[model samples]
Target: MDGKRALYYAAIGIAVLIGVSIVVSVVSALLSLAWAIVSGIVSLAVLAGVVYVLYKTGAWLLGGDDADYSASDSVGGSRSASASTDAAAESRQDRLRRQYVEGQISEAEFERRIASELETEEPDDVDRKVADIEQELERER
Candidate 1:
Protein backbone atom coordinates (compact mmCIF):
# COMPACT_ATOMS: atom_id res chain seq x y z
CA MET A 1 0.00 0.00 0.00
CA ASP A 2 2.78 2.43 0.78
CA GLY A 3 4.58 1.70 -2.54
CA LYS A 4 1.38 2.27 -4.51
CA ARG A 5 0.84 5.63 -2.80
CA ALA A 6 4.37 6.75 -3.64
CA LEU A 7 3.92 5.75 -7.29
CA TYR A 8 0.71 7.76 -7.51
CA TYR A 9 2.39 10.88 -6.16
CA ALA A 10 5.34 10.50 -8.59
CA ALA A 11 2.96 10.20 -11.52
CA ILE A 12 1.13 13.40 -10.54
CA GLY A 13 4.40 15.25 -10.20
CA ILE A 14 5.48 14.21 -13.69
CA ALA A 15 2.17 15.39 -15.16
CA VAL A 16 2.45 18.74 -13.43
CA LEU A 17 5.95 19.22 -14.73
CA ILE A 18 4.84 18.48 -18.30
CA GLY A 19 1.95 20.93 -17.98
CA VAL A 20 4.21 23.70 -16.74
CA SER A 21 6.67 23.15 -19.60
CA ILE A 22 3.94 23.32 -22.20
CA VAL A 23 2.57 26.55 -20.71
CA VAL A 24 5.96 28.15 -20.69
CA SER A 25 6.59 27.15 -24.34
CA VAL A 26 3.24 28.60 -25.43
CA VAL A 27 3.85 31.86 -23.61
CA SER A 28 7.31 32.22 -25.13
CA ALA A 29 5.94 31.64 -28.63
CA LEU A 30 3.25 34.24 -28.15
CA LEU A 31 5.79 36.75 -26.91
CA SER A 32 8.04 36.08 -29.91
CA LEU A 33 5.15 36.60 -32.31
CA ALA A 34 4.22 39.85 -30.63
CA TRP A 35 7.77 41.12 -30.85
CA ALA A 36 7.94 40.30 -34.55
CA ILE A 37 4.74 42.20 -35.23
CA VAL A 38 6.01 45.21 -33.33
CA SER A 39 9.33 45.15 -35.19
CA GLY A 40 7.61 45.05 -38.55
CA ILE A 41 5.42 48.02 -37.71
CA VAL A 42 8.43 50.00 -36.51
CA SER A 43 10.35 49.26 -39.70
CA LEU A 44 7.45 50.37 -41.86
CA ALA A 45 7.06 53.59 -39.88
CA VAL A 46 10.75 54.38 -40.29
CA LEU A 47 10.60 53.79 -44.03
CA ALA A 48 7.58 56.07 -44.39
CA GLY A 49 9.30 58.80 -42.42
CA VAL A 50 12.39 58.63 -44.63
CA VAL A 51 10.29 58.82 -47.79
CA TYR A 52 8.36 61.82 -46.47
CA VAL A 53 11.53 63.64 -45.55
CA LEU A 54 13.01 63.02 -48.98
CA TYR A 55 9.86 64.26 -50.72
CA LYS A 56 9.73 67.45 -48.67
CA THR A 57 13.43 68.07 -49.17
CA GLY A 58 13.15 67.63 -52.91
CA ALA A 59 10.16 69.98 -53.11
CA TRP A 60 11.97 72.57 -51.08
CA LEU A 61 15.17 72.33 -53.12
CA LEU A 62 13.45 72.31 -56.49
CA GLY A 63 11.17 75.27 -55.83
CA GLY A 64 7.67 74.25 -54.93
CA ASP A 65 6.20 77.50 -56.22
CA ASP A 66 7.62 76.90 -59.69
CA ALA A 67 5.96 73.52 -59.83
CA ASP A 68 2.67 75.00 -58.68
CA TYR A 69 2.86 77.86 -61.19
CA SER A 70 3.55 75.52 -64.09
CA ALA A 71 0.68 73.26 -63.14
CA SER A 72 -1.79 76.14 -62.79
CA ASP A 73 -0.61 77.90 -65.90
CA SER A 74 -1.04 74.79 -68.00
CA VAL A 75 -4.51 74.20 -66.66
CA GLY A 76 -5.71 77.78 -67.14
CA GLY A 77 -5.38 78.83 -70.76
CA SER A 78 -7.18 82.15 -70.49
CA ARG A 79 -4.14 84.42 -70.60
CA SER A 80 -3.71 86.92 -73.48
CA ALA A 81 -1.48 85.92 -76.41
CA SER A 82 1.10 88.56 -75.56
CA ALA A 83 1.07 87.51 -71.95
CA SER A 84 1.53 83.91 -72.96
CA THR A 85 4.46 84.84 -75.19
CA ASP A 86 6.07 86.79 -72.42
CA ALA A 87 5.54 83.91 -70.03
CA ALA A 88 7.08 81.51 -72.49
CA ALA A 89 10.14 83.71 -72.82
CA GLU A 90 10.44 83.98 -69.08
CA SER A 91 10.10 80.22 -68.75
CA ARG A 92 12.84 79.70 -71.28
CA GLN A 93 15.11 82.08 -69.45
CA ASP A 94 14.40 80.31 -66.22
CA ARG A 95 15.23 76.95 -67.76
CA LEU A 96 18.50 78.30 -69.15
CA ARG A 97 19.38 79.76 -65.80
CA ARG A 98 18.67 76.45 -64.08
CA GLN A 99 20.79 74.57 -66.56
CA TYR A 100 23.64 77.01 -66.11
CA VAL A 101 23.40 76.84 -62.35
CA GLU A 102 23.44 73.08 -62.47
CA GLY A 103 26.56 73.11 -64.62
CA GLN A 104 24.82 71.40 -67.51
CA ILE A 105 25.98 74.17 -69.85
CA SER A 106 29.03 76.45 -69.84
CA GLU A 107 28.65 80.15 -69.25
CA ALA A 108 29.42 80.91 -72.89
CA GLU A 109 26.86 78.40 -74.10
CA PHE A 110 24.25 79.79 -71.75
CA GLU A 111 24.95 83.36 -72.91
CA ARG A 112 24.74 82.34 -76.55
CA ARG A 113 21.45 80.58 -76.05
CA ILE A 114 20.02 83.54 -74.16
CA ALA A 115 21.16 85.90 -76.93
CA SER A 116 19.62 83.67 -79.58
CA GLU A 117 16.42 83.53 -77.57
CA LEU A 118 16.33 87.31 -77.26
CA GLU A 119 17.11 87.99 -80.93
CA THR A 120 13.94 86.37 -82.22
CA GLU A 121 11.55 89.23 -83.21
CA GLU A 122 8.51 87.16 -84.17
CA PRO A 123 6.53 85.15 -81.63
CA ASP A 124 6.08 82.28 -84.08
CA ASP A 125 9.81 82.00 -84.67
CA VAL A 126 10.48 82.14 -80.97
CA ASP A 127 8.02 79.32 -80.32
CA ARG A 128 9.48 77.16 -83.08
CA LYS A 129 13.06 77.71 -81.96
CA VAL A 130 12.17 77.10 -78.36
CA ALA A 131 10.52 73.82 -79.32
CA ASP A 132 13.64 72.81 -81.21
CA ILE A 133 15.88 73.68 -78.30
CA GLU A 134 13.65 71.74 -75.92
CA GLN A 135 13.82 68.72 -78.19
CA GLU A 136 17.58 68.97 -78.36
CA LEU A 137 17.87 69.22 -74.61
CA GLU A 138 15.58 66.24 -74.17
CA ARG A 139 17.71 64.24 -76.54
CA GLU A 140 20.81 65.18 -74.62
CA ARG A 141 19.16 64.09 -71.40
Candidate 2:
Protein backbone atom coordinates (compact mmCIF):
# COMPACT_ATOMS: atom_id res chain seq x y z
CA MET A 1 0.00 0.00 0.00
CA ASP A 2 1.00 3.64 -0.37
CA GLY A 3 2.63 5.49 2.51
CA LYS A 4 -0.53 7.58 3.02
CA ARG A 5 -2.80 4.53 3.26
CA ALA A 6 -0.29 2.78 5.52
CA LEU A 7 -0.28 5.74 7.87
CA TYR A 8 -4.06 5.69 8.02
CA TYR A 9 -4.12 2.00 8.84
CA ALA A 10 -1.42 2.46 11.48
CA ALA A 11 -3.45 5.24 13.09
CA ILE A 12 -6.57 3.06 13.30
CA GLY A 13 -4.53 0.17 14.64
CA ILE A 14 -3.10 2.35 17.39
CA ALA A 15 -6.60 3.49 18.40
CA VAL A 16 -7.94 -0.07 18.50
CA LEU A 17 -4.94 -1.26 20.48
CA ILE A 18 -5.46 1.48 23.02
CA GLY A 19 -9.12 0.48 23.49
CA VAL A 20 -8.29 -3.23 23.76
CA SER A 21 -5.58 -2.56 26.32
CA ILE A 22 -8.01 -0.57 28.48
CA VAL A 23 -10.65 -3.26 28.25
CA VAL A 24 -8.21 -6.05 29.11
CA SER A 25 -6.98 -4.15 32.16
CA VAL A 26 -10.52 -3.54 33.45
CA VAL A 27 -11.74 -7.13 33.06
CA SER A 28 -8.73 -9.44 33.29
CA ALA A 29 -6.76 -7.72 36.06
CA LEU A 30 -6.97 -4.64 38.28
CA LEU A 31 -3.24 -4.53 39.01
CA SER A 32 -2.51 -3.61 35.40
CA LEU A 33 -5.32 -1.04 35.20
CA ALA A 34 -3.11 1.91 36.15
CA TRP A 35 -0.44 0.88 33.74
CA ALA A 36 -2.96 0.23 30.99
CA ILE A 37 -4.59 3.63 31.37
CA VAL A 38 -1.24 5.39 31.29
CA SER A 39 -0.09 3.36 28.32
CA GLY A 40 -3.32 3.90 26.43
CA ILE A 41 -3.16 7.65 26.96
CA VAL A 42 0.48 7.79 25.92
CA SER A 43 -0.13 5.62 22.85
CA LEU A 44 -3.05 7.71 21.69
CA ALA A 45 -1.12 10.95 22.22
CA VAL A 46 1.83 9.66 20.26
CA LEU A 47 -0.44 8.40 17.49
CA ALA A 48 -2.08 11.83 17.22
CA GLY A 49 1.32 13.53 17.06
CA VAL A 50 2.54 11.15 14.39
CA VAL A 51 -0.61 11.62 12.33
CA TYR A 52 -0.32 15.40 12.58
CA VAL A 53 3.34 15.36 11.63
CA LEU A 54 2.70 13.08 8.66
CA TYR A 55 -0.14 15.30 7.49
CA LYS A 56 1.93 18.49 7.77
CA THR A 57 4.99 16.92 6.19
CA GLY A 58 3.06 15.61 3.16
CA ALA A 59 3.63 12.00 4.13
CA TRP A 60 -0.06 11.33 4.66
CA LEU A 61 -3.07 12.86 2.91
CA LEU A 62 -6.85 12.47 3.02
CA GLY A 63 -9.58 13.65 0.68
CA GLY A 64 -11.55 16.75 1.56
CA ASP A 65 -15.29 16.86 2.29
CA ASP A 66 -17.53 15.63 -0.52
CA ALA A 67 -19.46 18.89 -0.94
CA ASP A 68 -16.34 21.03 -1.30
CA TYR A 69 -14.74 18.53 -3.68
CA SER A 70 -17.84 18.40 -5.86
CA ALA A 71 -18.14 22.18 -5.99
CA SER A 72 -14.54 22.80 -7.00
CA ASP A 73 -14.56 19.87 -9.39
CA SER A 74 -17.58 21.29 -11.17
CA VAL A 75 -15.74 24.60 -11.60
CA GLY A 76 -12.46 22.90 -12.61
CA GLY A 77 -12.97 23.44 -16.35
CA SER A 78 -14.66 26.86 -16.05
CA ARG A 79 -11.60 28.99 -16.83
CA SER A 80 -11.21 27.45 -20.28
CA ALA A 81 -14.93 27.05 -20.98
CA SER A 82 -16.71 29.69 -23.09
CA ALA A 83 -20.21 28.18 -23.05
CA SER A 84 -21.97 30.98 -21.15
CA THR A 85 -19.99 33.93 -22.52
CA ASP A 86 -21.58 34.13 -26.00
CA ALA A 87 -25.07 33.95 -24.46
CA ALA A 88 -24.14 36.79 -22.10
CA ALA A 89 -22.95 38.98 -24.98
CA GLU A 90 -26.11 38.29 -26.96
CA SER A 91 -28.26 39.12 -23.93
CA ARG A 92 -26.41 42.39 -23.40
CA GLN A 93 -26.89 43.40 -27.03
CA ASP A 94 -30.60 42.52 -26.85
CA ARG A 95 -31.00 44.66 -23.71
CA LEU A 96 -29.28 47.59 -25.41
CA ARG A 97 -31.53 47.27 -28.50
CA ARG A 98 -34.62 47.03 -26.29
CA GLN A 99 -33.60 50.18 -24.43
CA TYR A 100 -33.14 52.07 -27.70
CA VAL A 101 -36.52 50.87 -29.05
CA GLU A 102 -38.27 51.87 -25.83
CA GLY A 103 -37.05 55.45 -26.28
CA GLN A 104 -34.80 55.20 -23.20
CA ILE A 105 -31.79 55.84 -25.46
CA SER A 106 -31.69 57.81 -28.72
CA GLU A 107 -30.96 56.12 -32.06
CA ALA A 108 -28.08 58.50 -32.70
CA GLU A 109 -26.58 57.77 -29.29
CA PHE A 110 -26.92 54.01 -29.85
CA GLU A 111 -25.28 54.20 -33.28
CA ARG A 112 -22.49 56.35 -31.91
CA ARG A 113 -21.90 53.87 -29.05
CA ILE A 114 -21.93 50.88 -31.44
CA ALA A 115 -19.48 52.60 -33.76
CA SER A 116 -17.20 53.44 -30.87
CA GLU A 117 -17.30 49.78 -29.67
CA LEU A 118 -16.93 48.08 -33.07
CA GLU A 119 -14.51 50.36 -34.93
CA THR A 120 -11.67 50.12 -32.39
CA GLU A 121 -9.98 53.08 -34.08
CA GLU A 122 -8.45 54.43 -30.88
CA PRO A 123 -6.95 52.06 -28.29
CA ASP A 124 -6.69 54.96 -25.82
CA ASP A 125 -10.45 55.66 -26.16
CA VAL A 126 -11.53 52.06 -25.30
CA ASP A 127 -11.72 52.72 -21.57
CA ARG A 128 -13.76 55.89 -22.11
CA LYS A 129 -16.18 54.06 -24.42
CA VAL A 130 -16.56 51.21 -21.91
CA ALA A 131 -17.28 53.75 -19.16
CA ASP A 132 -19.85 55.42 -21.39
CA ILE A 133 -21.50 52.06 -22.11
CA GLU A 134 -21.71 51.29 -18.39
CA GLN A 135 -23.26 54.70 -17.70
CA GLU A 136 -25.81 54.16 -20.48
CA LEU A 137 -26.67 50.69 -19.17
CA GLU A 138 -27.11 52.09 -15.68
CA ARG A 139 -29.42 54.80 -16.97
CA GLU A 140 -31.45 52.20 -18.93
CA ARG A 141 -32.07 50.29 -15.75
Worst lDDT 10-window in candidate 1? 70-79
Q: Candidate 2 — which pairs collide?
A: none
Which is the leading candidate under lDDT? 1
Model 1, 1-141: lDDT tens per residue?
999999999999999999999999999999999999999999999999999888877775565534534322322323344545577675877688678768899867986987787686477656655564555455545
List the candidates' TM-scores in order. 0.44, 0.23
Once superposed on the true structure, which residue ranges of model 1 sit more than 4 Å away at CA?
Answer: 64-141
TM-score of 1: 0.44
Stretches of candidate 2 above 4 Å error? 1-85, 119-141
What tens digits encode model 2's per-residue C-alpha lDDT throughout 1-141?
699999999999999999999998777787577779999999999999999776755522232222212112121222212323344343444456567868888877876766654463345444444555556556656
Q: What would you estimate as the lDDT of candidate 1?
A: 0.69
Per-candidate clash tally: 0, 0
Best of the candidates, TM-score:
1
Q: Quote model 2's TM-score.
A: 0.23
